[model samples]
Target: MSSLKTKEEGKVTQREILGCLKNCLLLLSD
Candidate 1:
């Protein structure tokens, strides 16, 4: 159960990092 929770949290953090990277790229392109 703890492992599952940690995996979920990692996924969420990965998604957030990806999103932030996308936003940064967009700003650079502009």
Candidate 2:
């Protein structure tokens, strides 16, 4: 159960990182 929770957290963090990267790219393109 604890492992599952950690895995979910990792996924969320990865998603957040991807979102930040996307925003940065958009700013650069502009």
Candidate 3:
């Protein structure tokens, strides 16, 4: 159960990072 939770946390962090990166790129492009 702990391992599953850890994996989910990692996925969420990765998604957050990706979202932030996308927003940064959009701002730079504008």
In order, candidate lDDTs are 1.00, 1.00, 1.00
TM of each candidate vs. truth: 0.90, 0.85, 0.85
**Model 1 lDDT, residue 10, Cα:** 100
Model 2 over residues 1-30: C-alpha lDDT tens digits? 999999999999999999999999999999
Give per-residue lDDT, candidate 3, residue 21.
Answer: 100
Q: Count the backbone clashes (under 3 Å) in each candidate.
A: 0, 0, 0
- Give the Å shift of residue 22 in candidate 2: 0.2
lDDT of 1 at 6: 100
Candidate 1, 1-30: lDDT as tens digits: 999999999999999999999999999999
Off by over 4 Å in 2: none
> Which stretches of model 3 miss by more than 4 angstroms?
none
- Model 1 TM-score (2 dp): 0.90
